[model samples]
Target: MTHAIPNVLTIAGSDSGGGAGIQADLKAFSALGAYGASVITALTAQNTRGVTAIHTPDPGFVTAQLDAVFDDIRIDAVKIGMLANAQIARAVADALRRYQPKHIVLDTVMISKSNHALLAPDAVAAVRDELLPLASLVTPNLPEAAALLGEAAVTDEAGMIRQGEALRALGAQAVLMKGGHLAASDSPDWLIQEHGTLRLGGPRVPVKNTHGTGCTLSSSIAALVAQRDDLASAVAEAKVYLTGALQASDQLEVGSGVGPVHHFYRWW
Candidate 1:
């Protein structure tokens, strides 16, 4: 007898380095025992060093991909990443309006791990207006949160909670402010809700192979949600999975620069 698996969709860019973007999301989904689907919005000439260039796919083609996926598949959750431009962001927003999947995890991928700008400067408002409200949870790193709020000092846990609260006020039901970029002794991320905030803390691993940690975490949350976990439980489980992935990444050498996490570490 065949068993049915939960399906999760990732709308993101293609990372040539295979460390992030759609590649990472698909890996995380499969690692979490979910069926993964994708709608690529941009292609990047990137490696561990940096993104040399980016080419945004046509908005019409992006919509076409979404239509194809939603027209046939029963997508349980969606993990959105790397909408490189306003047009792509608008298209994705339209698709979200059309499909309206049960759980939407938005990874506000403003900048890549290699220090390249993934989202345009002018598109921040578009993302906030079109996507953030539609997302069940918005996961943004320190820099992305700063960019979103136009504030330069959201670098601590208190600032993160404030920023998360501001983002939730802007319309996100929940916010997960990632602290991996912060230079703290204990890297503590805050999950802010209407009720209160829960701090998730863990020691920072001294590993350079953390290129796709954000994408992986958000995708893992989406996968867990697809499996019917509640929002808080899904986020908690994804954090655990990401911590393990980071700890187990020491064994692999994918690239000379920042490398990919070991998504299948448990199996191997």
Candidate 2:
């Protein structure tokens, strides 16, 4: 008898640049040895420089895709990103309740690297109220966390820890608050759980080719969780994988602008 490979589903927008969103998630899933599937909520005409245009798919279509994937595939985990609007967010929340995947890793993507709003301002509450509670783990960068909390932006390591706890209080089952925006010496992600807390640290690769780091990290976590039994172990494993990917990102000269993390085959 052949054993089935673990499956991870990515529900997000398509980055025409191929560095972020559904593309990045699928790459992370496959690199980690999981079968990858996707449900695209929007289409982004974007590149390494910036997002130029966005087209949101109909909410009904999003629901149909969700149903099709859930009905046929034995999805072990779902990594959610870039729900174009509140309608799409509600559809995703409802599907998660219905199909009940074993793990949900939500990357609450808000803004892009070149300072474009990815999620509509009207949709913030839907993500917080509707989608957040369903998440087994929600990975929010500094700005996204502050937006969800409806508070001033987190500015420091101390602020990251505090807001991470605050976001957990806001109904996420678990929280991973990233300090990527912090002007600190190192990039640290504070993981807040029910039993305890952990500060997962990594070398801040001083490279401009980090276009998909957030999506990559969250999907890596989802992929690892799908293949493992422990949440802490998954987070730890993801941290290692992401740090290496970031370091290797500079190795790939994909675009004239900011490039992407190499879906590396070797460990240096």
Clash totals in order: 0, 0
Instruction: Compose the digit string of candidate 1's lDDT tens values, residues 1-268.
Output: 0236988999999999998999999999999999999999999998888899999989999999999999999989999999999999999999999989988999999888767899997789999999999999999988888888888857677888998999999999899998887877777889998889999887888877888999999999999977855788888889899989999997888878888899999898
Q: Model 2 misses residue 121 by how many Å?
A: 0.6
Question: Each prediction's TM-score against the native?
Answer: 0.96, 0.96
Deviation in Å, model 2, residue 107 alpha carbon: 0.2
Tens-digit lDDT track of model 2 for 1-268: 0236788999999999999999999999989889999999999999998899999989999999999999998889999999989999999999999999879999999988888999988899999999888999999998898899999887888888898888888788889988888887898888999887888887788877888888998999998888885788899899898888877887777878888887663543
Off by over 4 Å in 2: 1-4, 265-268
In candidate 1, position 35 carries an lDDT of 94
lDDT of 2 at 175: 94
Prediction RMSDs, each to the true structure: 1.9, 1.8
CA lDDT, every model vs. true structure: 0.90, 0.89
The C-alpha stretches of model 1 lying farther than 4 A from their native spots are 1-3
